[model samples]
Target chain A: MASGDREESKCCFKEWMTTQEEDLSELFQALTVEPENIDQLKQLAEKSITHFQDYIKRRNKLAHKDISAYFAPNWCSPWENSLLWVAGCRPSLFFRLVYALSGSEVESNLTEFLLGTKEGYLGEVMSSTQLLMINALQSKTISEEERLTMKLAALQEDIADQPIAMIAKGLSKVGEMNGEVEKVLDNHGRQMVKVLEEADGLRMNTLKELVKILSPLQAVDFLVASKKLHLCVHNWGRQRDQKLGRKEIDEEC
Target chain B: MASGDREESKCCFKEWMTTQEEDLSELFQALTVEPENIDQLKQLAEKSITHFQDYIKRRNKLAHKDISAYFAPNWCSPWENSLLWVAGCRPSLFFRLVYALSGSEVESNLTEFLLGTKEGYLGEVMSSTQLLMINALQSKTISEEERLTMKLAALQEDIADQPIAMIAKGLSKVGEMNGEVEKVLDNHGRQMVKVLEEADGLRMNTLKELVKILSPLQAVDFLVASKKLHLCVHNWGRQRDQKLGRKEIDEEC
Candidate 1:
């Protein structure tokens, strides 16, 4: 019975793989010729970014799914993995192409477009940073609101003032975790705190440097777009967390 | 017997995982403290780049290994995949950190270090582009020298004049492959050709734009370093290809 169920899932996966391959082939066929002008290039960039965004959404969905889903531990097929690689590579190649063509004049537009992409590289950085912090704390879970607040505090200058205090609070919580963890922090946390403080500065400087390449309005657009994606991811995380909580309650009952 | 072999491989992989995790933990501890000055930051950047380069080398080594080796398709355990992701992410995060702190003065040094990192982003782009071309041709084998010549041609200006002609020859060969293939090409190949041609242009322009941010000497260093890594990957590919070829002959005999 279990083997039969696995076979069914494999068949479905194969069907999905066919559709994805067609999409990829179509993209490759479209790329046979390069765009001759800026307008054409921009269109290509937009298309690529859109496709890339779709893949990211799928990737994130897979990542956060329950253990019983298609990608449970030790169950990811090579075909599925290769598809993910292709999805990732396609958009990246397009992005590099766009970046290459974005001369000084269109640099700002390109920057805005890049940031506006669903959970773009900047957002990835923010999430990764938060993950690093969470790992250091040896925490079990981070709240959706916490993640959103942290991202907002980093991206939105008006609220950037809150991050330091937040960091302090987070550090104190880590200190409270246990004696052993606290001792680890005490031995190394001073430098870690300094790094965290400096990391915020670095983040801000990086954003400023990136935006300096853009016009003022473009810079504003970039930030606005980034904020939107951050909120989106945050909301998604919260929904997932709530669903998991409900499941746990039912299981316990 | 097969299950026993799998168990043996899993054990070896577990040993590798422990060592890698320790390295990662040490890196995190090192990064816990922020560098105090520009000089300190430079040292950090240098050390991080070296480590990143090492990861890239390992990644490349795994990629070119024969199918019978550590990573067989469909045999990738989640643990192995996660390790690959970590290897990729660690270098990228460090590269971004270095980029963030590299003010205009040190930008060149950072850029050179980045390009020198074994199969870094630029190398990734080049390799992807080659893969695209190879896939398009649907050919069984590509010579190592052919691949190396193509990369060197892209990276070196004195020889940059030759790649276009080489690309043209490659396209013509694709055209001659078969009537059905030619028909497919005739139907969709024009755009694909343009994309590849424009891709090369984009690549050159991208390099120029990135190098523009560096000092002239640094720019030269960047190119030189990039060229060196390209050759390294190319040579590795050749050696791997030879091994595979010899194995095939041995099997046939």
Candidate 2:
């Protein structure tokens, strides 16, 4: 902690991101192979999910010590940081992506596809039962999100009620701001870590459930969309940061 | 902001850290060369400083958007995060490293070197005037640190007085938690960024000034020590985190 330890963690996460990019490319290649190998496609889908699980596990371990870091990670652009829900994307984002993808496909091929003219595209992507399940999952995720938000609110209040209040009082008393203030802050940090853990758990479970509901080919497509969206957001955010003068333009060169 | 932008920034920093490692090894090689090449050493020293300055510039740009990210950077271990002073190591740390290095040298070679028994051991490393300059720099750094700490303390108080208080009140108002809460938090975030910018500026200035005071050889040696110490701390911290179960041991494997 005293030295470059954080640098090591940063390096580890960077490598993970690189791996994600490579995985995304592999998934894309799998999708385009003309023969349409179901077994290979399914294996790739499961492997992608496993890789994601590994990342979550690694992050969870890091979160235990410094959850606040994840909540406001420096590794992310300020724009991205502003949008973070409990240290990462909201679990409900999965449903939103799914809905958006489905809606767009239907809209583009509306006349032909809905009239039973397009057989493979519509039915193969999602069944009515799958749609219903997704709807339920969305509701469940939202409620869970609300519950976590409330817990976060309580912790935010405690920041004022506990450590901030103690520090304020100690300042007035002319010096004696050591052990007690630290203890309160430490206690707060522990609670914050717990909230983050719960949030991450919710995110992982939601992704797992959604993947389960997806057909193997559908899962691969969804995963591709998710990865692409994530990367796009990151790039877009960086551009925005540059435009806003929050980031240096010359660094890119 | 929404997706993987943080991942990009993390990767950038990880690359920077890797560059530092390579720079450190080159410096060590420079140090060990026989009949030391003063001009080459000076160039290397200056080059290292320039590289560091570039990093600071990049970080400063990022800080404009989300200063809190730097203050609680996720890239670092929680142990390292706990020790951070305004987004990084204290400016005074440079002085401490110098003193530790000098003191250790003096201690190890006391009898032979101090009694005019050894020629190139102590005098070539740190001149009397350089020590005085460093002492003065240390004092100035401490006062500046105190000032920044006070500013940070005020900002912490504002979290309770402004945003937290507003959120608490909004929660009770039945459904009015919209623009005002967001505005208050945004204002607070801006202030936080300014404080981070000022702190980072201080760190960069202190380092530049210290380098200005040292001889080329001394500066190179100091830079090597600093980089070595940083890398060592990072490794040590990771080990400690693993032992504490705050980090995954299997990740290394």
* lDDT, candidate 1, B46-163, per-residue tens: 4434443454344333332211123222223221232221111111221222122222214434566778642122221223444354343322111322342233222221111222
Assess each prediction's global lDDT (C-alpha) against the native: 0.30, 0.63
- Badly placed stretches (over 4 Å) of model 1 are A1-11, A14-253, B1-55, B67-253
Q: Lowest lDDT 10-mer window, candidate 2 chain A?
A: A244-253
TM-score of each: 0.23, 0.49
**Which stretch of 10 consecutive residues in model 1 chain A shows the poorest summed lDDT?**
A244-253
Among these predicted structures, which one has the highest TM-score?
A: 2
| CAPRI grade, predicted model 2 | incorrect
